[model samples]
Target: MKTNIKILALFLICSISAFAQSSKDAETVLQLSKDKWQWMADKNVDKLKDLFDAKAKFVHMSGTWKTDEELEIIKTGSIWYKEAKVHDSAIEVSGKTAIVWNRITLIAMVRGNEAKTEFTVTEVYQKQKKDWKMLALTFSSVRDTHQIKK
Candidate 1:
């Protein structure tokens, strides 16, 4: 009976260690979501592309999710963002995958008109080759725009 108890205790310790490792990996993947906002704020599309998987699908505020090819086209339009921030409201880490739900606040200019918008954004990332790559992203507008006097 003593030997059996020892084996059981060893098994429990191994299981808990595995769980902890998985949780850490998941949290690391989720951090990539925040890096995306910094990339956009910098208006360097190249950085965004580096983080994105080649097969990434990005859904715009227009209600249409574009494939990688389409997203690349949009990136070419010259993004000029004045302000962008991501508030990490919740983060859940699972093994080999992570889902980040956050609020994205941004001020941008389209045709020289300041556009301020908030969105509830969810981003999924995968671990590949020791790096986290954004696999998918979807967002919907949360709050409407209010004019800022110049």
Candidate 2:
């Protein structure tokens, strides 16, 4: 009975440690998301290449594409992010995967046309070795509060 109690206690300790680690990872991933936005605004394709998983999928209001394609677009100055003002965000971590929801106001240029819009972006990240790589990103356009009918 003593041995069984020790084993159970060990298991509980391990579980708690994992939860703490996951919380830390979530915070790191959240900060990485913010850094990614800064990179996008700066058009830093090289840095983006390191952050994004090779198999990453990027979905936007305009279109969807793989990591390589998105890099190409950014490299060619096709879609330029001028600013990303995050209003709120939330993060959830599950083992090796982390999901972040960010509500933001974006100022950008698409095909040389300036656009200012609000979006709720869902970003998925996966732990790889010692680093986290972005696996998927999806954006949904949000209506402005002023635009809602009272």
lDDT of each: 0.68, 0.91
* Model 2, residue 38: C-alpha shift (Å): 0.2
Model 2 clash count equals 0
- TM-scores vs. true structure, each candidate: 0.76, 0.90
Candidate 1 global TM-score: 0.76
Prediction 2 global C-alpha lDDT: 0.91
Q: What would the per-residue lDDT of candidate 1 be over residues 1-150, giving only the tens digit for each residue? A: 999999999999999998888778766765667666666666556777778788878776654554455344446533345666765446666666777777768777555578787877778888787887788888677863422221
TM-score computed on alpha carbons, candidate 2: 0.90
Worst 10 residues of 2 by lDDT: 141-150
The 10-residue segment of model 1 with minimum total lDDT is 141-150
